[model samples]
Target chain A: MAMKIGEGKFKENVNKNMEDTFMRGAVAGAQERLRTRRLDAAEELGNWEEWRSHGEEIRKHVLDNLDYYLHELAENLQKRGGHVFFAETADEATGYIREVVNANGGKKILKAKSMVTEEISLNQVLEQEGCKVIETDLGEYILQLDEHDPPSHIVAPALHKNKEQIRDVFSDKLDYKMTSKPEELALHARETLRQEFLTADIGITGCNFAIAESGSVGLVTNEGNAGLVSDLPKTQIAVMGMERIVPTFEEFEVLVGLLTRSAVGQKLTSYITALTGPREEGDADGPEEFHLVIVDNGRSKILGTEFQSVLQCIRCAACINVCPVYRHIGGHSYNSIYPGPIGAVLTPLLGGYDDFKDLPYASTLCAACTDACPVKIPLHELLHKHRQVIVEREGRAPISEKLAMKAFGLGAASNPMYAAGSKMAAAMMKPFTKNDRISSGPGPLKAWTEIREFPAPNKERFRDWFKQHEKGGGEQ
Target chain B: MKVTLFITCIVDMFQADVGKATVEVLERLGCDIKFPMGQVCCGQPAYNSGYVEESKDAMKKMITTFENAEIIVTPSGSCATMFKEYQRIFHNDPVWRPRAERLAVKTYELTEFIVHVLGVENIGAKLNGVATYHPSCHMTRLLGVKDAPMTLLQNVEGLRFEPLPNAHNCCGFGGTFSVKMGNISEQMVDEKVDSAEQTGADFLIGADGGCLMNIGGRIERRGKPIRVMHIAEVLNSR
Candidate 1:
């Protein structure tokens, strides 16, 4: 129910996720489909690289002057009669929202898919206050209906579930008989959510990007649920990570272009609603009261550090879509609402090493996520930075690994040590070698050998063979 | 052209045949190759494992080892990519930074050197078999050597090449990752092998030794008929 999903340990989570053949199939299928679609969309949008660069530049600029833009945004929002709250922590953000809901005597709350709210565990907090919180986004609605299944992915909250799984969840919870076809399942969810939209006293949505110039919060969605969440409710609360800000509409337009194309391979989502302040007089349909809660929750700590670039993320999930590790392990393995590459990097920073130490090491340093990032966050490098921190500063790495690395460093750095080690490797490994392979190895080799045969160390090392050939003592 | 061979530690200690094939192929291409005896590991194994300070010593040793070469070449794309990484690793040290940068600029993977430097795609090599190439992640994605191997492979006479499905994915041979995250690594390598088998190729070819070792080891264990060959071995074949 919190940012850290299940109670299982990191390894246990991964092992469990690995065994779920159904989830694995669903994740693999989605990855292949999403990866190809992203490529096609990028190809369609000529000069995608330039757009990415522009997106990167805009984010970097905003981050560099985040204080300035935050002030400007707050001022403009206040000028247009919108209450703004700067929450430095998750507790503060959730507490502020609860106060507002209680003040309004709100019993029912309608919500769009908002990761920040999930990160803060707002729904649970509200429910404990005897308030009924209903998720209106199709994915979030399914998850909410199924006794609060934590989101597996950022964009597709219910990505781990197949249509069949959704149908079962809907049938069991809502007493609706429906086929596993997507249209039927979606219609069933839509019909149920429409009633909540009309009746809810308050609505909560996550901001995709807040435009500083006009003090408008932008929401990009395929289901058009965010528009209803904002327009229908009397008091609408938009929660955002403080870093999700653009300096102006120009930058907002550039980022939105990158976000849609990168997230779901769409040129544009079905709806991109930008609501500035509560509403002007004579407005057709809009929230009478609007509140923007900018939640830091340890983000500001990353501002001046080596990982500041991570703040440039547009919540696109392009990195998640392309990550090979995520493809096999699935999103639940990450054990966070924000899964995949971004989650691996951000979770430890927000949640600390006690719970999330293994997330950084979860990668193979393949840089696939880095390549896929719309804003070019250099994700793999950041992951490595986390490793460096864990090893050097935190001292969280295992003692055995530390000892092995020390020996490795000494041997690799010294020419004599390396030569001697190389020469002695074959003899040392001879006991385990059989038919040019070690089917079962010892020490570190055990892990590798468990899955595949390890090559027997060559008795005649390449250097020796090359030396013999140079003297004409061996055949070429 | 004179090329100093940085036969990576993997080739020197484990897969010596890959190194031999690389030398023969380069020599046949009219290259005067020099073996840098002082060369050691590229420091990647330590660097990637988060032992940055410990790895720098090895990196500095490598930079000095190939200091005088006109061009340094290696059989392993991942190692060559590590050579390029030396610059970033030493960015803080003023003296070693420039040296690392110089070392990176002249270093090339064997196939990259052959196709890009020598301007030769086909060396008239012949091998009769259906083969699929696994573009190792570090080599193709980091070093940006995507086209060179394919350029040469397309020209190998009598060799029918089938593209490996989901070729862009990592083979789970992320050095220490194979050992540390063995469970996840198994799944990844298994998927890679499945894709390679799906191509119905008789041989699996790869530019990096680490990838070949992982995938090849799995194929051997599974008792699959597919043979794994280094790109160097394939190019050297007659």
Candidate 2:
């Protein structure tokens, strides 16, 4: 019900996910497809690097003047006859949303895919108040029907579910007999969701970027569910992270371009909805009352810090698409609503290191995330920063690791110690060495040797050989 | 050109043959090579694991060791990138920052030095075998030395180069990550080995010692019969 999805430890979650060949296969296939498409889209856009810089500049500018933009956005939204609430914590955000639902006597709410709401656990809170909450995005809908399965991926919530798995979930929950074809599954979900859209008393959506100049919330979707969720219900609520704001339409255009391309390799998604405030003066069907909930929930604390660059992220999942670790471990292994590289960096900041310390260490500092990032968050570097904090400030690293690292520092920094260590390494490892490889190594080598052979230490170190050869003992 | 070698600790101890090949290749190319005895580990294992202060001690040692070199070259891309990282590590210290920057500017990965500085691609080395190259992640992405190794490999006479599938993926050798998260690392290296096997290449060539050790160890354990060689060794082969 919370942002943190599973109860298992990070290792247990990874081991569990590693054993799920079905989920692993699905994730691998999706990663390959998305990675290729993202590359193609970047190439097609031409000057992707320039675009990335432009997007980074815009994001950095907005964050630099975030207070001004947030104030302007709220004032404009209020002028357009919308209620605006600033929730500092998850409980506050969900409580305010609950009050609105209770005041309106809302029984059933139709919701588009909104990660901020997921972060606040709004659905669980509303459902506890005896409201029927339905997820309208096809991915979310399938996940919802399967008994509140937390989204494995940020972009594609049900990415862990294959078509056959979806068919199974539908058959068990919805009593629908359908083949394992995407078209059929989508059509069934559409037919089912269409009824919920027509009958739901309220609609809730997540804002991609709130345009400050016009007080308009932008939503990008390929399925057009967000448009329906905002338009069909009489009372509409748009929830967004406090950091998700832009100064004007010009900045909004730039960010949206980066988001669509980096997230899904699209020039523009099928639907781009900008809802200013309720119906305005129009006669068309739209919400009469609109509310904007700006949820801080630990984001504002990240500002003016080493992690300020993390807020510049557009939730593209571009980093995740190329992450080699994510390819093996999958999204569920991250154990959060948000998963992969962004989640690894964010979950710790939002949830604290007690639950997410291992997340930072989950990476190899490959910098693939940094390279793929549209706004250039320097994600791998941020991951390293988390490690530094854990060791120096948090003092949460294992005592053994700390001692080992301290010894390493002494040995490596001093030439004599390094020379002695390298010299002794071969003789010390000789007992386990056979056929130029250590089959069963000692201490740290145990972990290495468990999965693969560790190369036996060279008895004659490279420097030794170099010294001998340079003296004309063998060559020349 | 006078070149100072930063033979990474991994190559110096575990893969001495890689270091030898590197030295022979560079010497044959008409360069006076020197090894700074004061140089030791790059401190990446500790630095990446979050001991920044402790790792800086080793980094400072490296900066001091190679302080007088006209050019510093390393057989491993990961270690060379670590030299570049020293500037950021000492960013707050004016004295160390400038010294680290100077060291960084002159440091080059082996293939990068060969193709860019020496202006030589084909070294006239010949080896007859089907091989796939694993572009180490740090070298390709962070150091931006994507084409240098390929350029040199392409010119290696009698060597049949097969493009490694999913070549952009890291081989699960994140130094300590290979041991710390061994379970997940196993799955990753397994995928890399499977992909290399799919290419039907008899040899797996890599630029970084860490990656070669990871993949090479796996090949030996699985008894896959695919030999692993460093790019330097492949280039020096005759």
Question: What is the Cα-based TM-score of model 2?
Answer: 0.99
Looking at model 2, residue A150 earns an lDDT score of 86
lDDT of 2 by residue, A381-418 (tens): 99999999999999999999999999999999999999
- Give each model's whole-structure lDDT: 0.92, 0.92
Q: Model 1 off-target regions past 4 Å?
A: none
- Which lDDT tens digits does candidate 1 get at residues A1-476? 67899778878888989999998898888998999989899999999889889889999999999999999999999999999999999999999999999999999999888898988999899999999999888888889988888888899988899888888998899998979999988888888888888898998999999999888899998989999999999998999999999988888888888898888889899999998889789999888889999999999999999999999999999999999899889898888887899999999988888989999989999999999999999999999999999999999889999999999899998989999999999999989999889999778888989999999999999999999876778558
Worst 10 residues of 2 chain B by lDDT: B156-165
| Candidate maximizing DockQ | 2
Pairs with steric clashes in candidate 1: none
- On a 0 to 1 TM-score scale, where does candidate 1 land against the true structure? 0.99
lDDT of 1 at A228: 94
- The RMSD (Cα, Å) of candidate 1 is 0.9
Model 1 chain A: worst 10 consecutive residues (lDDT sum): A467-476
Clashing residue pairs in candidate 2 (N, C-alpha, C atoms within 3 angstroms) = none
